[model samples]
Target: MTAVQRLRSAAVLSPPLLWTVVFMFVPYSILLVYSFWKTQYPIFVPAFQLGNYMELVRDPQYLRVLLRTLKIAGLVSFFALVLAYPYAYFLVFKVKRPSVRLTLYMAVVAPLWVSYLLRAYTWKTILGTQGVLNSFLVSTGILSEPSSIFLYNQAAMVLTLTYVFIPFMVMPIYAALEKIPPSLKEASADLGENRLATFLKVTLPLSMTGIVAGFTMTFCLAFGDFIAPFLVGGPDGVMIANVIASQFGAALNWPLGSALAVVMLVIVLGIISASDRFERLGAGRLT
Candidate 1:
């Protein structure tokens, strides 16, 4: 390429490249450096060490919390996929009217207009002992009084995360389903394949890209979430993020917090890598 072409390319990339360096790369680099340092009470000592990471490995409580965090994240992703896929399929295949499809899509995305904190707190209210569900059950004689069964548990955390992230799953799957050519199904039928066979072979394979995208997105978000757990995930329901928050907050242990953050980033990146492979495989099948 010509020097002018190179110059033009550099100019076009400069803004985003500078922004990433200043905001993302620099901050992450600082965190990475901090993760190897020691914290002396409120002061951060500049000495390089592996004590923070070593502590993470040595502490059974930290390992348990990490496991619980992964479990909750996996459950949230699975439930979100289960709930979102069918709705997306219905919107793409069953709904005939474009206007109705648009309306339904809007409804699915409408919750994003509200603040996430507000939504999390709203679930807290709905699941509380004296909340709407309990009140309804009591009034209908399903129970003699309001029950504490609904709130402050892993189940409550799962429910709230699933509700919050369902739309993330829905939109991607819908986009993939919408892109599928109607003629492909017709061709399969003309070739003497049954609907179920055609769907399993063609429809599902094509939609895997979106499924992988949605699942990865939801998993990462739910894994990093601290708010839902903080609001409704009582003693038994707390995840690793809560512990990480405490390390950075009241504990004032920056090194430990940075190490934990790095570990989470590594896991999230690994998941994304696997998802990318799945996406590539799906694309290859389509081609």
Candidate 2:
């Protein structure tokens, strides 16, 4: 390329590169630095130390919380996929009218237009001691009184997070399903394969990219979530994010908090990398 072309390219790229360096790179670098600092009494001192990260390694409680976070994230992703895929498939295949398909799709995703906090709060209200479910059950004589079983547990967190994150799963799968050509299914039918066989051999494999993407999105979101745990996941439902929040806020342990945040970032990046591989694999199968 000529100097002028190079200059033009650099100029176009400069804004985004500069923005990333300033905003994303700088903040993360600062967080990295803090992860190595030492906490002295009420304040932290600048020093190179692995004590914070080491504490995380040596701590069983942190491990347990991390494990719980993983379990919850996995469960949310699994349930979201289970729930979202069928609806997405129905919308793409079963629904004949374009207008009706759009309406149904919009209805499934309409919850996203509302505030996330409000959505989470709505679940909390529904599951609370005097919440709608309990009230209905009691009034209908299904139960003698309101039950506290619905709120403040890992199950509650899973339910709330699944509901909150289902749309993420739906959209990607829907897009993937929509991209599939009907001719492939026709060819499968011509070969005397049943519908289930065609789906297993063709549709499911082609949609793996979307499934991976949706799973990664929901899992990461659930992994880093704190609010749902705060609202519904009572004492037993404490997650890594909640622990990280306490370290930074109430505990005033910036070093530990930064280390935890860095770990979370690494794990999320690893998931994205795996999803990229799956997406490529899925796309390659079409050839």
- Residue-wise lDDT of candidate 1 within 20-40, one digit each (tens)? 999999999998998998989
Worst 10 residues of 1 by lDDT: 278-287
Supply the global lDDT for candidate 2: 0.92
How much lDDT does each candidate structure score?
0.92, 0.92
Off by over 4 Å in 1: 284-287
- Which segments of model 2 are wrong by more than 4 Å? 284-287
Model 2 lDDT, residue 189, Cα: 98
lDDT of 2 by residue, 130-227 (tens): 99999999999999989999999889999999999999999999999999999999999999999999999989988887888899899999999999
- Estimated TM-score for each candidate: 0.97, 0.97
lDDT for 179 in candidate 2 is 92
Residue 263 in model 1: lDDT: 93
